[model samples]
Structures are given as C-alpha cells and as structure tokens.
Target chain A: MGAHSLLPFTQDRDTAGFFEAAAEGRLVFKACLDCGHALHPPTDHCPRCGGWNTAWKDAKGTGRLHTWTTVMHQIHPDFPAPYTLVVVELDETPEVRLMGRLQGEPELREGMPMEVWFEPLGEGGPVLPQWKPVEA
Target chain B: MTATVIDDELAFAGRDKAAVVGIGQTAFSRDSGRSVLSLATEASLKAIADAGLTVDDIDGIVRCEQDNVRPYSLAAAIGAKNLHYWADTGPGGVAPCMMMGLAMGAVMTGQAKAVLAFRSLNGRSEMRLGGTGRHDAIEVVGGFGSYDEFYLPYGLQSAGQTFALMARRHMLEYGTTAEQLGAVAMACREHANQTPHAQMNGRPMSMDDYLASRMISTPLRMFDFCLESDGACAVVITSAERAKDLAKPPVLIRAVAGGAPQDHRPGMMFPVVSREDMTELGGRQAGAELWRRAGVGPEEMDLAQIYDCFTISVILQLEAYGFCGKGEGGPFAASGALRKGGQLPINTGGGHMSEGYVHGMNHIVQAVRQLRGEADMQIPDAELCMCTGGPLPIGSSVVFRKAA
Candidate 1:
C-alpha cells in the first residue's frame, strides 16, 4: 500500500486530540490533572492514582533513542526499502515513548539524543511524527 | 509502627485437574486449497477419535478469537450435541494455553465434561501473516482502535520489524551475535528434519544458510522468521478421572498461567517499546507462576516447546523462563543447549519455525506427543514438558507431566 493507501486513522473519543495536535505540529500525550502522571496513546483515567481527570499535554519534542530497527525488505509499496524506525523516550516523560521514522543515515547508538518533526502524508492525509539524530 | 497483611492460602485448585487425552493436526502446507472450517473440522474429528470419543461426547469448545471458524460453526459441523461451554481467547499466538486454562476451568466447575481446543487458518494461501497483509491490516491496524496510530503511519507495520528492534538492543547490551540467533534456527530446523509432517521436512538448514539468508529487518534474516503455512491443530481436554478410561496415556495439565507484567501498556503488542525492560517477555511472570503451581522448576523439564515466532523470541524466553540468567540466553543457545542431545531440548517438533505456525496449538500437541512417547523427535523417556505461548505480553505457559 502507498502513503495515500495508508490505513485511515479512526479518530474516536480517546485519540482525536492526539491526531489534532499532531496536525498542528505539536506532539501531545495524556497527563493526569490530578496526579500529573503521563499516559501514552492516552487513557481516560489515571492508572496510578485512579483519577478520572486527564487532559492532553504538549511534549518537548526531544528524546533519547531507546531502540531502533532498519527495514531492508519492502512490506508496503509506498514504504520503500532501507528505512529506519526508532523508539524515542520523550524528554518530558522518560517513561513514555513514541515511534517514528529516522530521517537520515546516521550511525545510531543507544541513548543518542534525537528530536521529533512532523511529515505530512500525500496531499491532505494525516500528519505523522518523524525523528532525526540531534547532537548530545 | 508498621502493619502487615497476610494474603489468602495458596490453593492451586487447577493443578493436575485436567489432562490432554488426544491430539490431531492437518498437514502443514503453503496452500490447503480448502476452507479453514474444513481444516478445523478435520482436525477436531481426528482429535476426538484419537481420544476414543465421538463428536457426541464433546460438551465444550474453545478457540482463538482471531480464528475465522467460530465455535458454533464447528459444533454444527462436528454434530456436537448440547454444548455446555464455549469461549474464545487471545490476540494471537498466546491463545492455545489460555484456551486449555479455560477448558480446565470449565471441567473443574462442572460446566463441561470434555472440551475441544483448536486453531485453523489459511495463513499462507489466503491471509499471509509475514507481511502487512489483509489479515494484519484489518485486525491490528484498521479494525481495532489500537496504538497503531503511532507506528503504522511510519511504515513500522510487520511483526518482524517490531521484533528486530528488540533483537538489536539485545545484541548491544549482551553482545549477542547473528550466529547465536542462527543456532536457534538451525536447531529447530534439525528437529523439523526428523519430523515427517513438518513443513520443512526433508529440507535441512545449516548455520551458513541461516547467516546467508536475506535480511528482512536488520539483525534478523529470513531464516530467523517462522513459516506462513496453512494448517490446523487440535487437542482434547478432560478431567483427570475421565482420562483414565481414554484410548491414550494422559498428559496431565500440571499447571497453566497467563498474564502480563505491571508495566505492560495497553495496545502493547505492537508498540512493546514503552516497557521498563524491552528485552523481557511476559514469560518471566507467567513462568514463575507456572513452576509454582506445577511444583516443578525449569530444570525438571525434559523438553521445552518455547515459542519461536522469531529466533530472538526464543533467546528472550530462555532468560524470561529462567532456563538461564538475564542476558545469558544468547550464550545458552550458542552452547547447543536447544539441540536434541543438549541440556533442555526445545521445539522437538521443529516448532513454528520449521514445523508450521498453527499459532501455538502445535506446541501443545508436540508436548503431548513427547510425553506419550509418540513424537518423531521424542526425548527418551520424557516425563515433564514445558510449553510456552508467544513471547508477547499477556503470554502463557503450561506444564505437562506424564501420569505417575
């Protein structure tokens, strides 16, 4: 499948805000208003303190590379070969992590500093978060 | 001043309460040219016959939630009368042991007399699992409102890619090598060579072949992945008492445990990245409870059918299940401990790698075969066998002991 044929995001009650914020060039996650606990892929309630008060919060858009993989085989027609996928532990919440594509061919090492950027899908499609190596 | 609270007594009521009386499976192939329901029915009937029971004797049926064939459809096809219990378990490869656990619950509660557990799919011909095909597209990404929103857009879609990240990290931390991973593939292929019904039967694989295999994802070559075959496997579970009168020697279900760790995130199957330790599988927690309830340690196991969706999964599970210390799995595997004459013979039936990926149903079937002295790659006088489901969160493990 091509970039245009990418699976459409189902914006429901829980995920509408995350995608909305991504469209605005800001990476967002859920944080408990009660106990200030961070949640990824956001939940309605705080798992830590059992609090119902949770709201969307913008992240610092910077993180340390926790792990990575380079795809050499083509699974999708749109996504060509030899692209690296990375998981970055957010600077704001070390426990919370986000996954995105790494832009360039950089010699990757664990704990390498990285920053997030947004890329638009083909012509009015959803905006996606991507990553690049940032100097320590 | 401190207060202490004591928990309730540890009464494992399900311990040795149920037994696997029969096992059956269809041929492992790339294309069955038949419907999945047909495959399931064939396997279910064969298992029932193997148990010396007819379809009329079955009172319960359990299957994986991902299965295309439903219990009602299966019951109708088998002509089962008055089904008392029916349930489905799982996200994927973790369902088999969980299904057995549920069957044990049903029999213990007097809800069902005999329970049938089966998995059937046209994984290769119709719905290939190796790539981002229709099956994964609908179930994982589109159908379920999962956390795929984060990774799917970035083209991080397949399980191979997801697991490659774990394998790479494991190498960096423990100095694990591609050769060690190849050992796992070679061992399973060796076992499959002995198994007549294995998909890779008559086709041997060597370390050189494994190393030379094309890379699908870095640190993981084609040989590291499991096969995408079309097949079905089924087993019959009944009370220990009823098993005494069965056609075959019973392989008692000593114990079973299934769950994830505290840090397991929701929709974590795809993005297992957020866990406190990325290299650890759910086997650590589940294996602990399994040994506790079975009253047996890992050392007592004559053989193990560790889940092998990929070679890295086997390495991680060896550690998580306490076969070796943390970060020692690579060395342990490299030591030839997974081979037939080695320390703990694993995947004696070739497993998902060279056998066929019937999810994990084949693992349980192979475990029973080993205990019953019927396995093609039988461990001599095998007494106790351990079978693990997938290495992902919400995983499960089961211990089977030959009747004393």
Candidate 2:
C-alpha cells in the first residue's frame, strides 16, 4: 500500500487588510507595549507580558531566509509540488521571523538574502506577502 | 473547583506548580465521527468527573488541541468559567506537563485556584467527513505549505520521511536494525494490550508484523509511526497540599523544563538531521537539565513515559536521558529490559502509536497513573515516573513522583 499519511486540511483565514497593505509594498509586524517584542505572526495580545496593547509597525522589508522547504507533495489537492516555503528573519527585529513563499524558482539554501513581495490571491482581496531571492 | 472559564478573553498566569486532580479521555479510535469540539467535551467531562469535581469548579483553562481542536471554542463547549489562562500550544505531547508546571507556578504565586490542561483531536472524524488539511491548488501557497516547502520539493515531506531519514542515520551510525525498531513497537504493544483504552489494545505484533507493515517513508515502516485517532485527554493541576484530600493520590510535579536545540528553527533538509544524524541534541540537553533539577537520574525512576511519535524517537530519548550511552540505544532496547516488570518499563500505556494519539498528553496521564498505582499494566511500586514532551522545533520533560 502507498503511504496514506496525509495532513488534515484547514480553512483559509481572511487577510483582506493584509492584502491592502501589501499592495502598497509596506511590510508589517505587531509590537507589544509591555515587552516591545515585534510579533512575527501578528497577534492581538503579547504572549510574554499578557498585554493586549499592540499595533502594526512597518518592517524594513529586508531579511535573510532563515530556512526554507521544497515541497514534493501538497497536503491539499490544489497545491502543486516543489514549492518553497520560507521563514525570513527580519533585520528590523531579531526575534521576528515571518513565513512566506519565494516567488521565483526556489532554491532552499538557508540564509539566502530575500526581499518581500506580494502576490494577489484568492478573491484577490488579500495580496499575500511572498518573497524572492535577492539577485546578485 | 471544577468550573472552567472559557471566554474570548485570553489570559494565563506564568508557569506555576499546580497538582492534577482529574484525568479523563475519550475512546481512542481512528474513524470516530466526533468533531474536535465533541471529543474535547467528552474527555473534559470525564476528567472532571474523575477528579470528583464539577465543571463549575474550574477557574482557569489551558487548551492543548492535539492538532485540531480550537482552544477558544472547546473552552466554551466545556462552559469554562473565570477563564484566566488559555493557549492552544503546539500539537506536541510535552504540552500537558508544561501546563502542569505552569499551573504549579500559578498556584505557588496564588494566581488561580485550579487549572485544567486539556487536549483534543478530531483529525480522523472531522477531516474524513469533509474537511482535511486544505492543500488544494488555492490553499497550498501558504499555511500547509509553510513548513513543507522546505523539504517536499527535495522529497522530504511527511513525518515518516523526516523520521525515516533520522532512523536511517541512526541505523548507519549506531548499527541499529529494523528488528530493534520492531522491539520498540513490540514493547508498546505489550503495554497497549494491557490498557483497554489504548488504540491498539490487545493487538499483538512481532518482528514480522513490524517488518511487514508497508513503508510510509523510507526506513520507517507504517508500524514505526504513531496512530492518528480522534479523542481528547485532560489533567487537572491544583495544589499537592489540597490534592491530599482529593479522590486520587497526588503525583508531585518534581520538575519540568522545555527547550529546543540551537538548530530548532527551520530545521529540515538544511541542518540538524539534514544529513541523518539520529542523535537528538535537544533530547539530551533537556534530559540533563531535568535530571539535575529533579535531583534524580534514569536509574532512580522506576519507569518512563518517553515520547514515541516514532520508535526511533524513543531510542534517541533513551540514550539522551542517560538510560544508556550514545549509539547503544539499539542494544539497550533489545535487552527486552524495558517491558513491564523490566528495569525501565518505558511507555507502559503504549505510546502515541499504540495509545491513542493526543499529541503526547496521554504519556503524561500514563505517568500519573504509574505513580498513582492505577496503571492498567501497573509496574511494581512505581514511585517515580518521568514523562517527555514530543519533539518540537522544541521539547520539554517532567518527573512525577507519587506524593507522599
């Protein structure tokens, strides 16, 4: 029998505002009032300080890909194989690393320089933030 | 004090020493039609009833959704009250004990009266019904693809694939064999057969069954992996002083700690295991710290509830925790010295593969049972039981002693 270890599916979350911001080419992060740790995956409250006081801050839009994966299989049927998912460690905040995809043909060597970009996705309301290798 | 608080307002007191007063679980099955919410409800109520407490008595809740259950919603379903602490930690098994450690901190600092750490999963029922990890053409560019993108392209996608790579490396370096891997599974089956609630209860396997199981990923046959079941598990942590008056013997939280190796982040085809080095640095590091803090070593503990997401993981953890020397995990496991009534008696409740999978929470609950003298395959006078959280990009461990 072939391997049947497939991952369960999850519904998409709306990020229309994220798309709106991405269309303008401004990267974002959430800053906690209590600890000042810039949240990589934006959240409403500070996990360390228990403080909900947070706001979106503009990122420098430059970072190195901390790690990347090359997909040979897709958990969902629609996704094509050989996709690169990457986590970019932003230079602006040492602790914040956001996940996105590399736009061009992907080579997943860790620590490659990356620049953020946006791709219009599902319903075209949210311009999903994507990344690409820095051309030397 | 079983009333649990599960409102939208998220809050948690930092780590504390809270004792477990209740324990509950739903039947472990692969195709149960229950939603994540329902399984959580079943386990939560059973646990509360077991604790001899009512749901209305709980004041804080920490949700460890074993890959599916939503914390906020499950909290609501259980009618959790006061609801101060809530987080849907990783799908790793080490979470429940981590919660207990935090509860102890809260109790010591006087932040709350009691906290319920609950984990629920409905991947089989919910997804098999209609919803599964959506990786369709439209969804694949994000989320599910997030971690997969690194390896799937290079042919390293599934957990079996990743673990197999590790196992292969271990085999090459330690001269381990497929039969030794079978020993780990065989041992867990022995324990599962004894525990009625275990997913593979009463099912017997030999080297043949283990070796015959079709390969899911190279070097990791199907039997080498964990079973996916729809269920929930919970452990209530209060105070040992107060726990003495409760329904069951209190299992003292000796010490609990969590950490990831420096190579934890974005680990994949690039490092840590990129080359198949099976020795886990994180497991070893956590073991040293846990032993030091608990004032004990592997020999002091009567038994262990090591995380067995994969048979190789158990072997690695055994060595890391000083059960034996590096690369000696194969012979160490082969000694048949780890089965019931054996010197170490690891995974007395089966492990993730044989016990129902609730991340690793069942392992924690099993350790509690060992200390409480309630284990189905109770080890003789099991006074100290150590539990490990499943690997993460991070990991954790806790040593539990039957409260005197």
Which candidate has the top score in lDDT? 1
TM-score of each model, paired residue for residue: 0.95, 0.71
lDDT (Cα, tens digit) per residue for candidate 1, span B1-404: 23434232333788888999999899989999999999999999999999999998999999999999999999999899878899999878999989989999999999999999999999999888877564233222432557777677777888898899899889989999999998899999999999999999899987888888998988799999999989999999999999999999999999998758657777747757887678987888898888888889999999999999999999999999899999999899999999999999999999999999999999999999999999998899999999999887667999999987
Write candidate 2's Cα lDDT for B1-404 as tens digits.
Answer: 24545332222222113467788888878767767678778888887788877777776677654446665576688887666655555545667757766677766666656777777776465543111354433323223324442233223345554555567667756789988888889999989999888889878888888899975544567788778777778888887777877888777887776666643434322234421133574667677767766778889989998888889888888887788898888888888967987778999988887987777878878888888888888999888888888764556788888876
Candidate 1's displacement at residue B17, Å, is: 1.2
Shift in Å, residue A77, candidate 1: 1.8
Question: Taking the candidates in order, what DockQ does each have?
Answer: 0.50, 0.06
Model 2: lDDT equals: 0.67
For model 2, the superposed segments whose C-alpha errors exceed 4 Å read A1-136, B1-17, B65-72, B127-134, B138-147, B267-271, B274-278
Question: In model 1, how large is the Cα lDDT of residue B8?
Answer: 22
Highest-scoring model, DockQ: 1
Candidate-wise lDDT, in order: 0.87, 0.67
